[model samples]
Target: SEQTNKHLYLFEVLVKNIDINRNLLNDYEKDLVIKNPIRVRIIFSDFYDVEIDEVKDCKSIHLPEPEQVKCHSKMSRTATKEKNGKEKPKQPKQKQKVPEEMMYVKKTSLHSQKAGFSCLFPMEPMEMLEKLKTSSLYFLIFSNMGEDEAKKIIGQAKVDVRKNFIDSVQYASATGEFPTTANLTTSCKIENVFKEVSGRIEVYVRLSCFGKFIMSMFNMLYNERNPANKKTDEEEKKAETTS
Candidate 1:
């Protein structure tokens, strides 16, 4: 059976590994020993006129101060080499740990209505994919909220959805591969999608689609099996009867 009101595409964006270049900052900003909170905004643009905006609070994520690594002197290196009779291999530096709050997750959905929904007929997956190819994602970074509560733009980045996600699905579909299911319940993750930004902002985006039928069945089964939901429904019914 055909299902209605299901999203053709769903994207989950995870923003992390955000490193702001202090050298890129203005002299006034660089002089400050302590900087203000940094804020991140995500925007998803499709073929439609409307763009989805996901804005996060300034204080939500706290960027940690950069670590200072001490350099070994030549004398120390020579002494170590002489003691061992050979130069020691360099140890790899460990990656910095990102805070839980610093990682932001945003979900965006593209529906058939946005592509041109019709009451008489359902939209096809191919048509939806065609429309999705033109979509793109935008990332904007800001530093230091002013007294008037305005964001100071620092850097920005853009990513094409087709290159990052849609094209891969199309290829998988054309090849009759098991990677993509019949219902298009497939997902792909992309890292470092941002480009042409002043500072480095690492991001991961996961694109997926679940047919309406599958989602509807899952919801129905979950409602039937959950006792807490049944109790709430019964309570609501009793309250209505009493009224």
Candidate 2:
């Protein structure tokens, strides 16, 4: 049966060696880590609204070849430039508007080799839960250990989850103000480091946060770069030429 209107959380883990030139590591350091390290990316997402289940059998999933994380925002900025000797007119920049409400998770101290890291979700419990139900969160764990070594270490690691009700009605009695937000944090760590792999390895981690919510609504197709839009524009140009 297809799953819909359901709340789901799945963690996607990837393991790969770090690229010396691409990563922030020196030649000697890169050489050391290359023999003993694995880069990891943990992608978390809410599959409640997805039509197809992405992670049906996630437990025994195999890691694919490593891929570099591109900065989409930067790519968008660069793609708007002129091409084919065509110069686009510059329009006046509009003032950016600030949003009324915002939520985020803050990491106090995060590292690759370390299994346990702290995450702080700054928002009300209900609000944060809603966000989780509608958004996808990513955690990048970089390691200086080889893929095999890193996997073994991660297999024995422990993850601890805790919730802190910062802003609550009862707590307001002592603090004189009602708490409006809650902090949800999790600590993860890999214990029992293997001795086979040595040297100071560095891991680069990236987290992707996506907000996708569906409340009684269906899918939305963005036409910004759709071929239909382009076809219409071309048709209009042809008509103009004929007229």
Candidate 3:
């Protein structure tokens, strides 16, 4: 029932707007896009492994808010200081990692209203779905749902939303022919492959390359920020001291 809800709500939402949000494009955006428009990301993040057990109160939804696109317009990524109040290291790397923060889809594009939307870009890749898959996340963990053509589609669509919404979007077709459902399936797989290796997207190939509805995997707590979900490090440390 929860999975059904997510499919209905959050996933469908991202499918529609991630490609283009009307609010992000104004007369100014529309005007500049005609000339030197491009997408901008205010946030840069590192990936870390998030176990299903470690996940906290990150908001899960069946659909994305069309309005959140506007809210993020004023959003800026501030590099948080370490708990010790020290600067973070530059070029940190791990053999494997999950994302440090729950990624928000925001992009600022320099393109036009006619060319289409302007908004914050998705900041990172690989760690989102790749983490989910790599860790084999089990949020009620259903499986063998009868030949999931939808699974791959849902997974891949999120990547498109992240890339296209964040960067730039352009549409084209090859050899001037209508592609088919099978074609779409193949496209999803291909995109996943490209994205996995380089964390880069092949958007020109993705425009009409896949499914009608995007997959939204919204359900469950996401981060540790909510008071309900949070246990401050100091409290934990104090407990350790008493114990």
All models, RMSD in angstroms? 15.2, 18.9, 22.9
Best by lDDT: 1
Cα deviation of 43 in candidate 1 (Å)?
Answer: 0.9
Q: Write the per-residue lDDT of candidate 3 for residues 68-121, one digit (tens) a residue.
A: 322111222235478899876443222223232222222322211101111222
Q: For each candidate, what TM-score against the reference?
A: 0.44, 0.24, 0.16
Residue pairs in candidate 1 whose N, alpha carbon or C atoms collide under 3 angstroms:
none
- The regions of model 3 sitting more than 4 angstroms off are 1-24, 40-130, 133-243
Specify the poorest-scoring 10-residue window by lDDT in model 2.
69-78
lDDT of 1 by residue, 59-89 (tens): 2222221121111101111122546588664
lDDT of 2 by residue, 1-243 (tens): 011222122221222221222244446545553344333334333321111111211222222221322211011111234777676655424322222221111111222222212122222224434444444433333333434543312222222211222123123223322223322333333222342212222223222211122211121232344668547656876988999
Ranking by lDDT: 1, 2, 3
Clashes of each: 0, 13, 28
